[model samples]
Target: MNAPLKITKVGNSAGLILPKEVLAHLNAAVGENLTVVFTTRGIELSAADPDFDQQMAAARDVMARRKRALRELAK
Candidate 1:
């Protein structure tokens, strides 16, 4: 849906207030976190995925523990 967004002062930071329809479209609610991704075209906002966050954390842990191994693999 095409929705015009305006950036307004939000506690010293500029923020956009999502309309109710936009929130519904994103399946998000107030106080919920949204993931921001910067793309070549522009930016993308989406609902945060708990599973992805957990997977990324696990991957980071493994990378830290296997730093040398990972470096060797990269080479």
Candidate 2:
């Protein structure tokens, strides 16, 4: 499942163009956001979870507001 990928210039940033077969295997299309995760082995790419991201943002806001309470509860 290894395919050679080339990094090309896209304005100021560099981008990689995935082959059609790889795109088909990932079920990804143009304009879709992908999440890149860095692991010990290597980098992993997956489709972004918009809903999960939104939920995490909300949780972070709540945690910020309730920092004192959460700290006490953790004791």
Candidate 3:
């Protein structure tokens, strides 16, 4: 169900008022930063700091592609 949002003042900034249920569902908290991406479809938000599997995969791919160059540089 889409609930109505209340506009409130946060110091000098205006912010959207979210319900407790919504916050609990998202597992977000105050002062936490989320990555928000605006795509052609719509907006998407996720935790910025996720598992390191993707990073490790990227490093492996780069190393595989530049094995010769890296070997030369190591000397």
Candidate 4:
């Protein structure tokens, strides 16, 4: 699962080419969008989900507006 990847120049920006085996393991195809997440441990790459992102944004807005209500409900 662990494989070394190299960053090569692509036009102006550098890009890393994922191995075919890695792509197949992740069920990713060429031209498919991927999401990069930075955590305390390290960087993570995963398939992008636009629908999930929208839903999370809506949920965050609701939580921000109803913080007290949610706290009371949790009690």
TM-score per prediction, in order, is 0.86, 0.78, 0.47, 0.66
Q: Which ten residues in a row have the lowest lDDT in candidate 1?
A: 45-54
lDDT of candidate model 2 versus the reference? 0.89
TM-score of 2: 0.78
Best by TM-score: 1
lDDT of model 1 at residue 12?
Answer: 72
What CA RMSD would you report for each candidate? 1.4, 1.9, 6.8, 3.4
Clashes of each: 0, 0, 0, 0
Candidate 1 per-residue C-alpha lDDT over 1-75 given as tens digits, one digit per residue, 9 for 90 to 100 = 786899999897899989999889889999999999999999998998869989999999999999999999998
lDDT of 4 by residue, 1-75 (tens): 888999999998999999999788767899998889999999988877869889999999999999999999999
Q: Pairs clashing in candidate 4?
A: none
Off by over 4 Å in 2: 73-75
Error of 1 at 46 (Å): 0.3
Off by over 4 Å in 4: 56-75
- Give the true-structure RMSD of model 1: 1.4
Worst 10-residue stretch by lDDT in candidate 2?
A: 19-28
| Alpha-carbon RMSD, candidate 4 | 3.4
- lDDT, candidate 2, residue 61? 100
Error of 2 at 22 (Å): 2.2
